[model samples]
Target: MEDTQVRDTIRSNIANKKHTSDKVMPGFFLLMASISVLTTLGIVIILVTDASKFFSAVPLKEVFSTQLAPLRETPSFGMLPLISGTLMTTLIAMLVAVPIGLAAAIFLSQFASDKLRRLLKPLMEIL
Candidate 1:
């Protein structure tokens, strides 16, 4: 009877421990997730503040003012060059990425053998 009581007590203790651990696990995960979100928000705020300061130093007149005719001689903002350069770089990057990405997809889906696929899938997952 004493042995039975000891066994029952041990079983109950283990069950209580498992229930407590399960409850605590989600709280721990929530804490980690909240920390990650706050860190990301902090980084974004810092970047925005830095960029705002950079843009604020430039004269608004230079940014928004339109050029007059050559005879009238008003200041030109000429932001078009910067816009065009950004577009050109973005287009070039897309052009370079699309073909390589498509080729990789095709090879993985159509050409790779089953064993190779299994091996590569795990490798890609680890990466």
Candidate 2:
């Protein structure tokens, strides 16, 4: 009888403590979400503004003109060399990353025990 009364009292307390939307309201959360979104949009606008200024200062002729051999008069844009360098670097990075990433994933999945796997899964997700 005492245990039953104790359980009944605990249940009543929990029922009384139940949260209702009427208490705190939802508008506060909605306002915070809107502020976060607006801040992100403002950052994007600032970055685009800075990039446009940089592009505007450089002459299009220098970027788009053709290269010429020695003693030639043709206007030359050296952008192609820069573009090729960037592509080569990107390819090298991807080549190195793909094999290493695959190896790490295979090691984790195939070699780890269940307890280690559970711990590592969350750690990887956090990263």
Task: State the weakest 10-residue window (summed lDDT) of model 1.
Answer: 64-73
Give the C-alpha miss distance for residue 114 in model 1, angstroms. 2.3
lDDT of 1 by residue, 7-83 (tens): 99999999999999999999999999999999999999999999788568746555543442323455345465666
Candidate 1 lDDT at 53 equals 86
Q: In angstroms, give how far residue 26 of model 1 lies from its true place.
A: 3.0
Deviation from native of the Cα of residue 91 in model 1, angstroms: 4.3
Q: Candidate 2's residue-wise lDDT over 1-127, tens digit each? A: 9999999999987776665544455677878999999999999999999978856875676665445233456534447667777899999999998897787678789998889888887876574
Give the clash count for model 1: 0
Model 1, residue pairs in steric clash: none
Alpha-carbon local distance difference test for all models: 0.79, 0.76
